[model samples]
Target: MKQIGVLLSKNYKLLSVAAILEVFETVNKFYATAGDELPFELNLLASHETIENQKESFGYQLQSIKDVKQLDLILIPAFTSDNMHETLQANRLCVPHLISQYNNGASIGTFCTGAFLLGASGLLNGKIATTHVDASDGFAIAFPEVNLKADRTVTQDGRLYTSGGATSSFHLLLHLVQEFCGNEMAIKIAKVFAIDMDRDKQSYFSTFQPSRNHNDELVASAQQKIESNYHDVTTIEELIKDIPSSRRNIVRRFKQVTGITPIEYLQQTRIAAAKKLLERTGQQMTEIIFNSGYSDPKAFRKVFKKSVGMTPSQYREKFQVR
Candidate 1:
C-alpha cells in the first residue's frame, strides 16, 4: 500500500484536509469494493503529540510527524487564513520533515495557500508553482526564487505539485489520482466529485483587486487615478499626473506596495471593467474595447488572451450572465 501522509498542520484549512482525506478514502473504497486489497494507507500527520490520545480517526490514522520516518506521498492543505507569515511561523517545524520526505523521493502536492508552507521549505526554489490567484502577488513577493505560474490550475515539477485557489484543489487532487491510480480511476472520481477535469487554467476566475495594505498616499493617489480613469487614461503618466512624485520613484513604490507597476494596475482595471461588461451585458467586442480604454481591437484581444488565458468571446461564453 502507498503510504499517503496528509499534514494536519496548524492553521490548516479544515475543508482542505477533509477533501484530501475524502478523495483517498474513496480511492481505497473503490479498490476494496472490487475485492482488491486497499491501495492506500491514509495517515494524518500531526505536528503535536496530543492527537495520538484522541480517538477521532474517521477512518484515517493520525500519526505524529515526529514518529513517521517515511511516506510515499505528502499532501499539504490550504491554510485557514491567508496570513501566511504567521501561518508558516506556526508550522515551521513541519518544514524540515517535508524536506526530508521530499528528498527521499516522496511526491508532495499542495492546495491553494498551502504552497506557502511548501515554498517556505525551500523545496520550490526554481520550481514552477502557484497558489490562490489573489494571493499570487504575495507568494511571488515572498518566494522570488520560485517560478510562480499564477494562471495554471495545476503545475507539476518533478514530484512537487501545486494548485490554484479554492475549488482548484479538486483539479490537483484529480491529477494526483490519475498519476498514481490511472486515468480511468481519476475520471471515475471526477464524476463522483462533479469536477471538470479538463479545466487547464484558473486565470478567468481572477479579479484585479488592488491592494490598499500600504501607507503611501502617493501610491494610493496613483491607484485612485487608475481606478477612476482607467476607462479613458491610456498611459501610466496620466495615472500619476497629479501625484507629487517622480515617475521612477512612484514606479518603485508602486511595485513595492502593490507588487505591480502603475501600468499593470491600469491594464488590470480596464480588464476588470471589460470582464464585468462581458459578464453582465451582451456588449459587442468593439464597444467593450473602447469603453475599456482600448481603441485597437487586435491589441486588446491579445492582451486579454495573454492575461485572462482566454479570448473575450470564450470568457463570455463561459461566464456570461443568462
Candidate 2:
C-alpha cells in the first residue's frame, strides 16, 4: 500500500482532490484481497481541524487535508479559486508545508493552480513544470526560476509532478498509478471508473483552437477536440481555420501560451492513447498500431519506444502479463 498525503487549504477545488481519491479507491478495489491489506492509505491534511467550505468558482469544496508523515506521495489539489489574492495567500500557506513533506522523502505533486503552490515552495525551481494556462504569463513572471510548460497537462520532473487543471487531475493520477503500481492496475481502475483505460494525450478529447485566449469556452472546446480526435489526420492549418487566427500566428501563440507546437501536442496525445492500449488490451502490436493512428507498425514501434523508453511488446510483457 502507498501512503498519499493530500494538503488542503481554504476553498480548495474539490474536483482536483476528489478525482485523485476516486482513483485511489479504484486502486483499492482492484487490489483487494480476501481478508487482506488495502492497497492505499490516503491522509487528508489541512492547516486546521475544521473542514472549510471550498468556494465554487468551478465546483466542489476540498473536504480536508490529511496530517501524516513519511508519505510516499504528497498531492496538492486545485485551489479554492483562482482569484489572485486568494490564490497567492493559499499558496503561501501550502507551499512551505509541501516542501517540508518532500524533504521528508515524499514525492510532491500538484494539480492545476496547485502547481503554483509547488512553484512558490521552490520545489519546481530549475524544474520543468506546468500549470493552468490562464496563469501562464503571471506565473512565468513570478516564478522565472521554474521552466513552466503552459501547454502540457502534466510534467514529471524529478520527484515533483505538476498538472494543469481540475480535469487534468485524472490524467495525472492515472499516470502516477501506472508509475508506482503497474500499468495493469492502472488500466483496471480506469475501466472501473468507465473511462477508456488507454486514453492519453494522443487520444482525441475535442478540436483545436489557435487563440491563446483564456476563455473557458474556447479552452474547453479545444481540450475536448484534442482529447476526442488527437489522432485525426487534420492539420494545424485546418485546426485554426475555425478560429480567427493565421497559421504562423497560431503556432506562435500556441507555443507561447501552451509551451508546445501543435504537432508535438498531437504526438503526445497519440502516445497517451498508445499507453492505454499497451497497458489494458491484449491486442497485437499491429492492432494497437492501427487503432492509435499509426499506419505503419515500424513507425509505431519507433515512436512508442522513444516516448515510453521501451518497445510496445516489452511494455505489455512487463505490465500486462505480470
Candidate 3:
C-alpha cells in the first residue's frame, strides 16, 4: 500500500484536511467492497505531536501520529492568516522537513494557501504552481521564483502538485486518485462525494483585485480613477492627464508595479464590474455592456470570454441571483 501523510499545522483549515482524509477513506472502502487490495495507508502527520487548532477555541486540538518523513505522498492543507509573511515565519520549521521529504523521493501536494508553505520550502522555485486566486498577489510577491498560475485550479509539475482555493482540494485529490488508481476509481469517488468532475480552472470565480500596495502615488491615483471611472470610456491619454508623466512612462511604471499594462487593467476593471451585474441583476445584455462602459456588443463579448473563460450569458446563468 502507498503511504500517504496529511500534514496538519497550527491554524490549518480543518475542513480541507477532513476532505482529503474522507476521500481516501471512502476510496479504500470501495476497494474492499470490490475485493481489491487496499491501495493506501493514510496517516495524519505533523511537525509536532499535538498542535492547537487556530480556528477554534482553546479546547480543540489536532493530534498526529507520523512525523514529516518516509511517506510516498505528503499533502499540506491550507491555513488561515491575514498576513502571509508573518505566518510563513511562524511555520518556517516545516520547510527543511519538506525539502528532506522531497529529496527522499516523496511527492508533495498542497491545497489553497498551503502552497504558501510549500513555496516557503524553496521546492516550488521555478515550478508552475497555483493557490487561492485571492492570494495570488501575495504569493507572487513572496515567492517571485515560483510561477503562480492564478487561473488554474490544479497544477502538477512532476511530483509537485498544487490546487486552488477551498473545495478545489477535492478536485486535486480526485486527480491523484485517477493517476494512481484509475478513471473508474476517480469516477466512483466523484459520485460518492458529489464532486463536479469537470472543473479545471478558478478563473470564473476569481475577482480582479487591482494591486495598490506599491509606493507609487501617481500610479495609485491612476488606478483609483480607472476603477471608479471604469464605465466612462476613458482613454489611457485621459487617464494620464491628471498625472504628471508621459504616456510611455506611465504605462511602463504601471506594468512594473501591477504586472499588467494600463489598458489590460482597464479591461479587467470593466470586466469585474460586468461580472457583478451579471451575478446580481436581471439586466439585459445591452444594459450590462453600457453599464460596464462598453459601447460595442462584440467587443464586450470577446473581452468577457477572454477574461472570464466563459461567455457573459454562461456566467450569468451559473451565478445570477434568483
Clashes of each: 0, 29, 0
Please give the distance, in angstroms, between residue 185's alpha carbon in candidate 2 and its true position after superposition: 0.6
Where does model 1 exceed 4 Å of error? Answer: 49-57
The most accurate candidate by TM-score is 1
TM-scores, each model vs. reference: 0.94, 0.57, 0.90
Predictions in order: lDDT:
0.89, 0.68, 0.85
**Ten-residue region with minimum lDDT total, candidate 2:** 200-209
Q: In model 3, which regions exceed 4 Å deviation?
A: 49-68
- For model 1, what is the C-alpha lDDT against the true structure? 0.89
* Top candidate, metric lDDT: 1
- Expressed as tens digits, the lDDT of each residue in 98-213 for candidate 2 is 77778878898888788777777777889998877556555776788899777677789889998765566777887898898888877766676665444333212222223344
Q: Rank order by TM-score, top first?
A: 1, 3, 2
Regions of candidate 2 where Cα sits further than 4 Å from its true position: 33-36, 49-67, 196-322
Pairs with steric clashes in candidate 3: none
Ten contiguous residues with the weakest lDDT in model 1: 49-58
